[model samples]
Target: MIAALGLAELKLLLRNRTAATLAVLMPLAAGLYFALGVGGEDDSWTMVVTLQLLFSFGFTVYVTVTTALTARRQDLYLKRLRTGAASDVVVLTGILLPVVVLGLAQALVLLGVSMAAGAPLPTRPDLLVLALIGGAAISCAAGVCTSGLTGTAELAQITTAPFFFAMIIGGLMGMSGGEDAWVFLIPGGGLGTLTGAAWGGPTDHVLEALASVVAWTAVATALSTRFFRWDPRT
Candidate 1:
């Protein structure tokens, strides 16, 4: 049942030109530009790759999920899905699975681009994977939380802006090579640290970074559970 719903959601996602652009083309374009077009003697590959992952999660996963959920609710699709045999968890996962998958795929592609542009290979593949998963999970949960407050799919652009910017800013702060403890409190900060460490940037505080990602994921999940709606807001 989840597979069927996921396939349906994927089809719907591909059919919507605007959503498809945002999910598929936009991130790829921006990431390729960042990896290939931008260059500086002082540029850290870790920072560039971290920003790429941030963009993939922020626009592809986060914005797309919020838009999809609010659009489905407005169309009564979410309400109808809940009436079926599938559990709420299954339904929600099915709807979000494609977006998450797309986000991860984009992350890998952008990482490859960075590597092709002469960035060193990740020394810690496991940590890189963990960062990717944590980033996607947090972004997905935050999307669900945002969807509850989004009256329309069109409004998701405005609603998702705050966290989207936070993600970028956090990445910048994490890559600043400083010891600012408060940086990890932001959305993408810990993920950036983990990504950097994966690429041999710094490993002294990996556990702290992991804990930050876990904490953010927990908070976002809790808020999503508390606020996510299956019906459109009136």
Candidate 2:
């Protein structure tokens, strides 16, 4: 049942040109642009790769999931799904699975492109894996929380802007070597630290970075559990 719903959601996402662009094209394009077009003697390729991942998390996964959820809820799709054999977790996961997969795929593509463009292979693959997994989970949960506040599909873009910008801006600051203790507190800061560590930065902050991502994921999950609405807003 979950697989069927996920397939249906994938088909719908592919059919929508705008959603397809957001889910795939935009992130890839932005990643390539930043990785290839933006360069400086002091700029690190790892930082470029980290920025690309941030774009994927923010503009791709976060935005696409929020828009998809709000659209489904507004159209009564989520409510209908709840009446089927699927449990709440299955229903929600089915709806979001495609976006999550696409986001991760894009992240891999960006990593490949970055490497092809001469970025060093991750020194700590474990940290990179953790960052990718944590980023995807956080983005998905944040999307659910944002969708609960979105009254319409059209409003999803606006409602998701704060999180999108927060991750992007915070990620940029971190990648640029911001060492402030509070940097890890930002939504995507931990991801930046982990990715930086993957690029061979200091390891002392790994625990702190992991903690930040876990904390954000917990908070976002709690918010979604508490307030996510299946019915359209009146």
Candidate 3:
């Protein structure tokens, strides 16, 4: 049942040309832009990895999931799913699975492009993998919370902006070594730390980074549990 719903969601996602383009093209384009235009003569894998995370996990995942969830709620699709035999977890997971998969694929594509463009392979592959998993999970849960506040599909972009920008800016700052201690409280800060560690930048903050990611994930999950609405907003 979950598989069937996931397939249906995938089809729905593909049919939406705008969403499909953003999910596929945006990450690729951003990666190439940063890799070629930004990295310059210094083979900086940090820039590549940071940009990939920002574009893939930050923008693409958050916006796509929020928009999709908002559309489904507005169209009564989520409400209909609630009436089915699928449990809440299965229903929500099925709806979100495609976006999650796409985000991971985009991450891999970005990594490949970065490597081809002269960025070295991750120095700490484990840290990179951890960052990717944590970032994706955080983005998906954030999207659910964002969708709860969105009144319509058209409003999703605006509604998701604060969270998206927070991640982008905080991530950039964290990656650049702006250590205020509080930056790690933001969703993307831990990801930045982990990604930086992946490039052999620092390992002293790994535990803090992991804790930050886990903490944000917990907050986002709690928000979604409390506020996520299946039906359209009145």
Q: Pick the candidate with the highest TM-score.
A: 1
lDDT for model 1 comes to 0.89
- The TM-score that candidate 3 achieves is 0.96
* RMSD for each of the candidates: 1.3, 1.4, 1.3
lDDT digits (tens) for residues 47-160 of candidate 1: 788889999999999999999999999999999999999999999999999899999999999998888888888989998999899999999999999999899999999999
Each candidate's TM vs. the true structure? 0.96, 0.96, 0.96
> How many collisions between residues are there in candidate 1?
0
Better of 1 and 2 by TM-score: 1
**Candidate 3 at 165: error in angstroms?**
0.9
Error of 2 at 210 (Å): 0.2
| Residue-level error in angstroms, candidate 1, position 134 | 0.6
Ordering by lDDT: 1, 2, 3
Q: 1-234, model 2: which lDDT tens digit per residue?
A: 778999999998889888888888899999999778873323478678888899888877899999999989989999999998889999998989988888999999988887877777788999999989999999999999999999987788789888888887777666544478799878988888888888888778788888889999999999998879999899
Q: Which stretches of candidate 2 lie over 4 Å from their true place?
A: 39-42, 176-178
In angstroms, how far off is 74's CA in candidate 2? 0.6
